[model samples]
Target chain A: MGGRAGLLIAPRILEDVSRGRDIILVTGTNGKTTTSAMLRAGWGGEVAGNDTGANMIQGHVAALCASNASRAVLETDESWMAVVISSLRPRVVVLLNLSRDQLDRANEVRRIALGWRECLAPETYGGVVVANAGDPLVVFAAQEARHVRWVDVPSSWRDDAASCPHCTRAITFGDGGWSCECGFAKPRVFSASVGATLEIGGESFEWGLALPGSFNEVNAALALTALAECGVEVATALTRLRTMTTVQGRYGLRRFGGRTLRLLLAKNPAGTAALLASLDPEDEVWIAINAQLADGRDPSWLYDVDFDNLKGHRVTCLGERRLDLATRLTYAGIDCAVVDEPESLQGEGSVTVVANYTAFREWMGRSTPC
Target chain B: MLRVAVILPDLLGTYGDGGNATVLAARARARGIEVEVVPLAIGAVIAPADLYLLGGGEDGPQRLARDLLVEGGFVERVRDGAHVFAVCAGLQILGTTFSIEGDASYPGLGLVEATTTRARARAVGDMATMVSGHMMVGFENHGGFTSLGTGVEPFGQVLVGRGNDGHVDGYRAGRIWATYAHGPVLAQNPWLADQLLSEVTGESLAPWASVADRLYLERCERVSTRRSAGDRTAGRH
Candidate 1:
C-alpha cells in the first residue's frame, strides 16, 4: 500500500493535517528510526511519529493521519527530508551523522549533504537544526542553515568523510576532531557527551540509557537537545528517555526456535562498527544479510565492517546473502558456519543476531515473547 | 612473502573493494605463502609489491585518486610490469579519461587504452560473466560505460547483467586486469583471485576450491535465473 500509490497520496494528506503541529524531523544515514523514537519518548506533549521505520513521505502521512496530536516527531529518510520538511515546516530538524549507506539506491554522502544545504537555507527553512558537529557532512549541511544547535556526537566511522565535503581536501583528525585544510572544521559543539555524562550549557548531567552502545548515547544527546529546543526541560526529557526501552524490534530480546536472541540492526559500516564495539568478546554472534530491494542488493558493505572484532567468537552467517557474509568472515580470519534458516542457528544460549534492514525485519517478524 | 599494496583505499574503496585485497591476502596465506597487506594512504611513497590493487569510489575521489597517483609516479610502476587488479572506478582512473556527470571529463592514468563515459542510466544489479572460460559472479553498480580500444582485449563476456557497458565487462592486458564487478569480485570468484595470484607469483597455481566456489556457483545460478525470468517477462510484455 505504501509504494507509488502511497507516495502519490501523501502530499494531500500532509497538506490537510500537518499544519499548526510542532514537528521535529530527524534524519541521517543511520539511527533515524531510533532517534525519532527517542525524541518522541522524551517529548512531553501528545506526539505522533513513524515509529515502524517507514520514513518516506507515505509513512509520514500515515503516521500523521493516525494521530491528531499537536506535536509530531517524524523520522525522515535522508533523501526525502527536503520534501517532507517543505510540506511539514518542521519546527526542529535533527541532522545526525552521514556515512555511506545503500550506495546502490542512494546518492553519495556529499551529494546528499549538498541537497540538505539547499533545503535548509534560511530563506526556505527557518527552523532550528539540531546537528552533529562530529560529522563533517552534517556540519557542511547545517552550516548553511540560519540557526543550528550543534552536538558533539563521537563519530567512529571516518572512512566516508575522509575528504572534506566542502573542498574535497583530505580532512585531518586530531585531538579537537576533524578539520580540513580548506578552513572548514568541526563546528562548535552546543551539547557534548563525555563518558556517560552529557554537558549542555556547561552543566553536566549523567545519563544511563537502557539502549546499548555509545551511538545510542549520542542519539540520546541529540534527542535531549531536540527536546530542549522544543521547550521541554532537560531533566524531564532525560526521565522520559529512561522510560524508553526499545525502538521498533531493536534491542528486544525474543525467543525464537528455543533460543533467546537479541536483535540488533546494523545497516551500514558505521552502525555495524558501533554494534561490534558494544559486544562482549566472548559473546556468540550471528550476522544475517539480504540483498532484497529494501536491504539494498549490494552486500559489498560487509567488507567495510571491521569483522575482525568477532575474530575469536563463534559466528553464524544467515540470510539470502549468507554466503557473501560467510565469505567476508572467512577473509576477516573468522570461521563462520553458513545457515539457510534462522531455526538452524538456534541454540540454548544468549546469541546476538546482527542483521541488515530486511534481515532484521524478517527476524523481527518471527520473534516471540520472551 | 607476497606483499599486496592496496592503493589509496580510503579514497577508492567505497564499495567494499578493500575485500579484494583481503581475499588476495587470505588466498595467499592459505597456500603457505607468507603475505603482507600494505594499505598505502595518499601522499605515501609507493613501493613495488607482488600485486597492487585499487577499488571503486565516487567521482570526486576517483579524480583525486587519479591525480594523486599521477603526482606520485605510480602510473609508471603499473606500466613497468606491476601486477595490478583494479575495479570499477579504479578501472576508470586507469583509463585515458572518464566522463563524469555534466560533461566533465577527468584525466586518467592512461595505463589502459580505453575511455569511460557516464551512461544515461546506471547499471546496478547482480552480474554473472564468463571470464576466460571461467564463470565469475559478482555485483555491478556503475554509471560509467567504458569502451575499450581495438588493440585491447576484454577480460570477459557478459552472460547475465551489464558489464563494462552493456556488452564486454573488463580489460585484460598483460599483467593488468580491471573489472566492474565488486562482489569484492575476488571473494565470490576465487578462481579469478587465484589467476591474479598465479600471474604475480610467475607460477600456475592449482585450482583451490573452498566454500567460496559453491557460493559462487549458487550466486551465478540465482542471478542467471533472475535475469532469464526478467527477460521472459519483458518478452511477454
Candidate 2:
C-alpha cells in the first residue's frame, strides 16, 4: 500500500529509500521468507524488511518507506536481484541455492543463474556475497563476485544441478565435491553447515534455532554468516536466531478439527520433498494443493514430489487440486482420501498439514494456534 | 521379468520423468511381472535391458546426455530390437538434429528421422493428443519446433494443444516411441503403458485402469472445455 502512494508521490522511490542504508539483500528459490526473517531477528533492532513473504519491488519500497532505520534486510526475488542490486547498492548480498521452481512462470533455471553471474560481477556489485558452495548453480553465479565468503551448505535436491551451469556438461559429485568434466567446480568455503552448527574459520558456532528441518539448519547457518558480514558478532546473531519461532504463520502448531495441526508450506518439488522427509512416517499428514496465480498455473509439479515417503502413514488429500494429489498418491501405493474441507478429514491424530502457497494461507485463515 | 533402464535420469529428469519409470514398474508389478528399474547415471555402466526410458531436460544436459548415450553404444542397443521411450528433450536427443539456446543446432543419436529448430515462441501449457487408438494427456513445455521427415510416423495427431507444429505430436517407429507429452506420458495413459508392457511380454494385456485413469479422463474433459472456452495456453508465433 505504501509503495503505490510512495511511487505516486515520488517517482524515484526505490533509490530514495535505499540510498545510504546498510541493506543486506537475500535472493534464492527456496527459504527466502524464513531466511529473511532470521536475518531481521539476528539484526536485533527495528530493521526494515518484508516479513509477510513479499519480496517484490513494491514490498521493498513499502518496507523502506515505513522505516527510517539505518539497516534494512530485504528479501529479493531471484529474477529481480539485478535490478535491486543496481538500484539499492546493498552493502552485503546473500545468494542461496537456485533450483527449479514455478516452471510455467519462471521456466529457465540456467538463464536466471547466468543473469546473476553478470550482475554480481565485481564491476557491477561492490558488496560481499555470502553464498552456498555446495550448490553448483549458486557457486557458478557467485564466482564472478569480487568478495565471496562461501558456505558449504549441502542440499539433497540434486536433480536441478546434475549438469554444469558453465560448460553444460555432466556435473560429478564425487571425491572432488562437485565438478564438471570441463573444470567448473565448487569454490573453497569459509563456513560449512555441520549438522546443527555453523563452522567458520576452524571454529563451530551452534545455530540451532527454534526452526525445524535440516534446511532450516542451513538457513540459520547462512543467516548468521550474513549477519557476521554486516559487522554483527556471531554469538549475538546466534542468540537472537533462537528467539525466532514461526515465519508468516509457517512452522506453527495450531488447533483445528480437534487435532494438533502443524502448519507447513511447500510450493515446489524440492521444498515438498524436504518437508515430507521431516514428517513422522507413523502419523497422519494432510496434503493440500492449489494452482492459483501465486501457486503457478501448472500442476505438473505434483508428479515431481516423492510421495513414497508417505508409504507408512495415513494420508489425506484436500484443496482445489485434491484429485491431482489423490492420483499421485494412489500411483505411489499410498492410501489416501480426498476431502473438500479440513474438518472432513477422517482421522483422530495430531495431523501435520503440508500445503502449497495458496492452500496454506487458506488452511491458516480458518485456524488458530494451540 | 521386465528390465527397464531409465537412461541418465540425473541428467534428463528436469520435469518428473522419473515418475514415468515408477509408473511403468508399478503397472508391471501389479500384473505379477518381476520388474527391475535401473536409473542410469553419468558414470554408471550401460546394462542391456528390455526397455529404456529417456526424459525431458534443459538444452545443455540434453546435449550431454546425447553424447553419453552415443559413447555408451545406446543406438546399437536400440537397433538390437530393444524398446525406447523418450519425451521432450529426450525425444530431440534421439533425433537427427536439435537446436538449443536459440540457433545452436547439434547432432543427435540419429535414432529418429526428425529435426528441431528454435521456435519464434515457446510452447508451455496443457497438451492432449490421440495415440495408439487412445487419448493421451500431458503438459508440453519446450522451445523447439520439431520437423519430422517424410515417412516418419507420428504417435498421435494433435487433439488439443500445439504438437510438432500443431498437426502431430511425436514420432513412432517399431519399438521406438517419442513424444512431447510429459506427465510421464505413461502415467496419465494406462493403455500406452500396457501397450509397451505387452510388446515386451508378447501378449495383449487386458485393461487395468485405476484411480489414475479416472483422474486422467477427468483432466482431459477439463482441458477440452478450457480450450473451447478460448482459454488455450502456450506461447505461439
Candidate 3:
C-alpha cells in the first residue's frame, strides 16, 4: 500500500469475475469481438459479450447488467480496459493483437499499451494477463508486469508490427512468430490449435469452424488458452469448442425462403484481406459497400486488398456509398450488378452477402420468409 | 454466390468493428453461401455489388477516410445503385458533412446530405433500437450529434434506449440507412443482416433468418430465467 494505488471504476464487473465463477476479459485493437465471442463459446459461461459487436464501457456494462449469474465472459475495448480493470480486476484478461485502430481518440497503439501497462502494473498479483506473444506491443506490456501468462502465437503471424520494446529494434517474423537480434522471442508455447479443433458442451471435436481463415485459428487459440488458464480442463474446454456457435452477424449461417446467405463484417485492410483470402474458389458471391464515417470516412483502404482473384462472381454495390464500393469493384474487372434493394434480389447459387458492421446486420435482420 | 465489398475509411481497426465483416462472411457460409469479400479502397478498381456495409470508428479516422472517399468520387457512384447500409461512423460519413469535436467539420460523402456533430457527452449504452423498415434489434454506442437533414430521417426509434444521436441518433435517407448502435450490430441481429441481404438479393425477407431474432428473444428470456433461478439459489446460499 506504500506508493501504490489501484483504481476501481467498474466494480461490479470485476466482482462477478473474481468469485471463482468462469470469467474472461477480451481486449484488443481487432478480433476482440470474434475472440471474446469464441472465448464465451469455449468457456460457455452463460455466454455474454459485445455480440452486437459494440465493444465499449456501456456495452460490457450492459452485458454485466444483463448477466444473471456470477460467472460470465466479457469483452472490453482497449480504451475501456484501464477503467474496467481499475474496478473489475478480472481473474484473467486476454489481450488480443493490437493494431492502428481509431485515429481520433487513441491514435497510437503505444498509447493503448502504455495505458494498459500502467493499469496492470498497479495490480501485479491480481489477474493473469493472457496476451498474444507474437505481438510485440502486447509482449512488451506483459513484460512490464510482475506476473503474466503469455499465450503461444500460431506459426503464422501476418502483418507483424514488430519493434524492439527495449532497444527499439524492428522485430521481424521468420518461421513461427517474431524474433529480433535483441533476443526478444515469443516464448509462450501450446499444443492444439484453436481453429483446428472444435469443442462442444462436453466433447472435443476435430472439425474446423464453418468459416475459413487463419486469424480465426488464432482467435480460437486465444480463447482456448484463456479458458484453460482459468482452470477449465483442456478436455472440457475442447468440448465447448466443438459446439461453438456463430454470434449472429459475425459468421452466422441460415437458410430462409429457399436461399442460403453467409454474412461477414469487413472494416479494415487486415480484416478485409483475411475476408478476401478466406473466400473459396468454388463459391459464388455478392458484395455491398457503405461509405459512412462509422465505416471510416475515407473508404480508401480498399486498394490494399488483392482483388485480382475476384473472378466469376455477381457483385452488387449498395449503400449511400455504393458507388464508392462499386467503382472499386468495377476497376478490378469483376462484373457486378447494382441492386437498390438487397431484400428483393434472388439467388440460386451459393450466395455470400458482405457488408460492414451495420449493413451486414441489416441484411441479416430481414424476416426469413417461408 | 456471395459478394461482399467493404467501403473502409481508416478507422477499421477500432473496436474490432472489422470483425463484423468476418463474422458476416462466416455466418453466410454456415448457410452454404459462397462468399467473395472485396475491399474497395479509394482509387482502387470499383465494382457494383449486391450489398454494401459500413462500420463505426473514431472521429479522426472518419475525417481522414472522408478525404480519401471524396477524392475518388466513389461514394456518389456507389450510392446510385447498391442496396446500402451504414453504421455509426458510416452513417455520419454518408451525411453531407459531420463536425468533429464540435468545431472542425468535414464534408461527408453527401450521399445522405446531413451533418453529424460530436456530442458533448457520448451516448454509450445497451439500447433497444426498434427495427422499423427491417425486422431487427441491436445495441448503439456513439458520441456524435447526428441531425437528419430536410429529406433524411432514422430507420427506427430508440424503443428502450438511446435514440440515434444520443437522444437524437438514427437517420434514414431512402435506401441509405444509418444509426449509432453497433449491436455488435450483426452478431445479435442476423435479421438485420438478412434485411440488408434482401435489399441485395431482391428477395423477400426469409422467416428462418428470424432464427437469430427469436434466439435473441429466447436468450433474453433465458437470462431472465437464469437470473431468477440464481436469485433463488442465492437466497439459499
Best by DockQ: 1
Q: Residues B1-237, candidate 2, lDDT per residue (tens digit)?
A: 789999998788888777788888888888878999998998887889999999988877888898899999999899988899889998899899999876988999998899998888788777887886787888888888889999999989876777777778889977889899877677777778888889877877666767777767877888788778876444443
TM-scores for all candidates? Answer: 0.96, 0.95, 0.55
Where model 2 places Cα greater than 4 Å from the true spot, the runs are: A1-11, A346-348, B232-234
A7, model 3: CA deviation in Å?
A: 16
lDDT of 1 by residue, A1-370 (tens): 5433655755466756789899999999888988988888888668898888888888888888789899999888888877888899999999988999988889477789888999999988999999999888898899989999999877788898887777677889888587988999988889998888999977889888888888899899998998888888898889888877778888978888878889999888889989998998778888889888888888889898887689788899898888888888877878889888666554588889899999998888887758
What lDDT would candidate 2 get against the real structure? Answer: 0.84
Kindly give the stretch of ten consecutive residues in candidate 3 chain B with the minimal lDDT sum: B228-237
Candidate 3 stretches greater than 4 Å from native: A1-22, A45-50, A102-106, A122-125, A155-169, A181-183, A190-207, A210-212, A255-258, A331-333, A367-370, B1-237
Error of 3 at A105 (Å): 5.1
**Model 1: lDDT to the true structure:** 0.85
- Between 1 and 3, whose DockQ is larger? 1
- Put down candidate 2 lDDT per residue, A1-370, tens digits, no spaces: 7787777887678998889889999999899989999999998888989787778888899989888999999998889888888889998888888888877677778889998999999899988999988889999999989999998886887788887887766788875388888988888888888876788768788766788788888887788888988888888888888887888889878877678788999999889988888887676888888878788766667777878788888778888778777877877888887777666654456888899999999989877877
Tell me how each candidate scores on DockQ against the true complex. Answer: 0.77, 0.55, 0.03
Global CA lDDT of candidate 3, please? 0.60
